[model samples]
Target: MTFYVCIKRVGDILLSLTAIFILSPVLLVSALLLLCTGEHLVLYRQRRVGKNYRPFNIYKFVTMRSDSEKSGTITAKNDPRVLPVGRVLRKTKINELPQLFNILFGHMSVVGPRPLVRSEVDMYPEDLRQIVYADNQPGLTGMGSLFFRNEDDLLAATGKEPATAYREDIMPIKGALEAWYRDHKGFVVDCKIVVLTAWAVLHPGSAPVIESFRNAPGFPEKELTDYRTLLARTE
Candidate 1:
């Protein structure tokens, strides 16, 4: 392995294990809460395209009914399928904590492109598929993930069918952003992405700040700026 990959793998193992240990209590409580509140699984696992276009089960704390995606793949704002506890988990991104296990198992990296389902993968334009998916492991957080952190809200605002909006409007942007990260992948870049992701989670209203951090070549600057305006109005 190259020096970067060697160091990154080491860091991933250390950080992921530490996080799982520290967050075990939260994980347990969330699991208990899910069991007490409804008839749903505490953890949700679904197949997502990973590095080399390999398939792996991505895990997350359950945020919706077992068959919620049967109705639709995208979750819009005020999506009724999300349980009350789920809303808190989703908004706080606590729902993603279970992916720490995926990281430990080498199915993911702490910082890389966010994995997409097979359907989403199938829609990736040819160039993006070769650049972003063929050679990189999907991440817990990365450029595309942080840029579209408010994905459900974006979809809700479109007034188009959720899947339609995602395919036409959101997916292309995500593809570009992921492609950018693939080019810029490095220890320093991953650190910055992780820090920005934490900042976005804590300050969901800071669109301008988030947008500033995303200034990179090949990104659709105009679209991000427009989305920032939309986010500002919502705030």
Candidate 2:
């Protein structure tokens, strides 16, 4: 795991710096649009669970109304706080590009479980903590993220009860997916996930990545069972 972390860290740092150069125009445009909308801040920093379950402020280019956290951490599709450009950023996953900086600083990786906010981390089922954030750094892109690319819409569609649906429906599947990544950590699998992420963002389709997950092995049975329990309840 340490070797993986070392490899992942160096890989991410180089890539993040390169990403910043290539995506400068997009970031500038996003920042300007956010300003015009009176969103003010160009970046949003929020506390998220990190390696060793430590809390750290994760950075993201601000995409919603300032003070959006007054409502909550999770963003549902059509969330009123979403700025005009924010929607585009979210759709293209451009919003996450800045976190490459996080990777450079050792707060994130190119592949691993997406970090959860402290509040949400506390809500995670304690019994499953080991599998949830066990190995691999929380990454810029990951299996769970690939699986739930449309999550904001799903949560929003829950309508007046976003919290309930998120807690019982959305969260559990993410847990299963992340736990799958945790136990199956390896370079080949990691590279495959990163490739899937790129394909998903660039192509905006489900075919390739969906097939990959369906074929992936070593996803913990307990996690899948827990996921089913949640799905059954949600249904």
Give the number of the best model, judged by TM-score.
1
State the C-alpha lDDT per candidate.
0.82, 0.74
Provide backbone clash counts, one per model. 0, 0
Name the 10 consecutive residues with the lowest summed lDDT in model 2.
226-235
TM-score for predicted model 1 compared with the true structure:
0.91
Q: On residues 131-223, what C-alpha lDDT tens digit does candidate 1 reach at each position? A: 777679899998778878888877777778887878877777678778878877888788888888888887775555455656655566765
Best by lDDT: 1
Query: Counting only residues 3 or more apart in sequence or on different chains, how many pairs clash (N, Cα, C under 3 Å) in candidate 1?
Result: 0
Error (Å) of candidate 2 at residue 120 is: 1.6
Error of 1 at 84 (Å): 2.3
Each candidate: RMSD? 2.0, 3.2
